[model samples]
Target: MTPEFGSRRTAIVTGGAKRIGACFVRALAEDGWTLLIHCRESVAEAEAIAAEIGNGARVVAADLATVDGPDRVIAALEGMPPPALLVNSASLFELDSHDDFTAEAWDAHMNANARGPALLSRGFARAVPAGQGALIVNLLDAKLAQPNPDFYSYTISKMAFAGVSELMARVLAPQGIRVNAIAPSVTMVSGPQSRENFAKVHAMNALHRGVDVDDLVRALRFLVASPAITGQTIAVDGGQRFLSLPRDVQFMES
Candidate 1:
């Protein structure tokens, strides 16, 4: 069914063109929510996804790394109802070590992964009407809690987002807006990796398996639907958060 203009409840999903972000868009589409799917580059992919969903799913292209990007996204919705849900799923993941990390690299990661989400959430909060409720879900990494020095800049940026989630949750609660985060480990992305490597990462957790997209989708739905839950970070990491893997074990033993 097609949503009447400005009639259906809306959701803004950053980085919704691909990967886990696309999964969230699909799930919300199935639930009949109108969507504003935001992407940085992937224009063709974003358009294709909007066409596939077909319930008034519109694509907005914006580089979240820029200071004005989030405002651009909000401005694109001028005639429509403000979004009731905002999913901050767009992130940059780069491998950087302390020895090699540069100021430029750190800023790039922080701009996309941390500052972007905070600004987007701030915009979303401003759009919501008084006494009405809204939800914001920030995507995070399970390793933020564990502190992996391998992905130094990425980890630090995600940690910043985690803090953003909590601070926004408390600050916006009075406005009836709730903010929370989801941290997932070893989830498959749209990238190339050997099966052996994939299996090794999957087995790093206590459950000996990685958290799937479905697991994350369920957690997100729960957070959005649960009114009492706020300022919490749920790690859907198969118990990886509780135990640290041995440094020598890169892959599962044959």
Candidate 2:
């Protein structure tokens, strides 16, 4: 007999419709997880992925930048079984040179990237059953370390959330819920602007190469599966952190 959605081991993956999030959804699905994929403007893409996965896959639409978005997602998953995993993979990334930054920009970046994940993490902690091995994986960026002069707000928000990974892990670990974060360097598979951003990143890395999105998804999979690890920021960058590359290299290359 097929299990009901409530009966299956499930995960709520925010922004699981496309790109790295979609890759994460595919990985979790292969692990036999029922997916509640939360997407903002990517409803059609989310639905398409749900259909492809075809077993206990559901799509939720919400602008996580708002105050109520996290609650709405939790409501959808509440009917499911007690043991649930929450992947806080949704984030807003923008690059405004320091001089171009505005109050609206600061709030917008904080809301979507930092506040939303914190809200979701709190909700998941309360919702998932005790001793059921629940996990929350926050998708962070290596930009937190490098400090993008143009993308300060976005990077700062991510750094804040990255710090929370340890705080939540310490408290939640006793409850059988593990909280960890992944800080990826620029990935090869985003958009045109992102590609350009990554080109700069590739040159910055010690290896002078870009990283595959698949490698990041794999790290996420390991984080979700390993109960022994928690409160860690796993860098998926290809040794980029060690190298102190100059920012002027980007301007010169351009």
Candidate 3:
């Protein structure tokens, strides 16, 4: 028989302090999922979320950019039941042009966006019972296919993480653990965004609409509830993936 919502089931949401991560935390909490919200520097924000969620959530701070960051997060959950859900929402987004790229910048993106998710998923899989099932939802970017030159390192790292989602799903399926990803396009905001800026971004998509935090939350819920889907990425970008880019100047001129 399936267990109750808040019975023994737990979810670990990395970077669950602010922005998209915090949205996931609140949504899961409302669904009666006990959450371990991990944050790197948003301790006060994390605390606020924990308090807001009351009994359904708690917080843990870990720097996912370091080698031991994932370990520290997993260690914090030692006494609880193995989390049935792992949301790798914690990531680093930085701008790096190819001409000015540095190893340090590349490494930072790889460590946080790619390596951190891979390691956290690994740890969560190990903690689950041999025959029991688990789910991992990785956060990805909508431009994963159309690589943005402006955010060079960030784009590359997210691409690597998308590959990790597929690889993990294939390897862990036999154990009943499913892995999937959600590629959202400008769903959450870090600061005040003017209507003009919003309209400009919205105009780039096929739907002529911008994604909101609720859209991402719905995608997460669908992935968690669907038992047959695995190793796939759902682009919740209002059909932006289908949009085509203009040809180069020479081609256009021809």
Q: What lDDT does candidate 3 reach at residue 179?
A: 92
lDDT of 3 by residue, 11-89 (tens): 9999899889999999988887788999999999999998999765778898888889888888878666557899999
Q: Evaluate model 1: give its TM-score.
A: 0.92
Pick the winner on lDDT between candidates 1 and 3: 1
Candidate 2 TM-score, C-alpha based: 0.89
Q: What CA root-mean-square deviation does each model show from the true structure?
A: 3.3, 3.6, 4.2
Better of 1 and 3 by TM-score: 1
Model 2: residues with Cα > 4 Å off, grouped in runs: 1-7, 189-204, 246-254
- In model 1, which range of ten residues has the least summed lDDT? 245-254
lDDT by residue for model 1 (31-105), tens: 778889999999899999999998778889999989999999988777765578899999887766889999998
lDDT of 3: 0.81
Q: Model 2: per-residue lDDT, tens digit, 1-254?
A: 01222346778899899888898898888877888999999999999999999776888898888999988888878565454678888888766657788899889988998888888889878887654667888889875665546466776778788877778988887787788888887674342354565465455567766778788978987876676878888888777767644442233243
Which runs of model 3 end up more than 4 angstroms from their true locations? 1-6, 190-196, 245-254
Query: What is the Cα root-mean-square deviation between model 2 and the actual structure?
Result: 3.6
**Candidate 3 similarity to native, TM-score:** 0.90
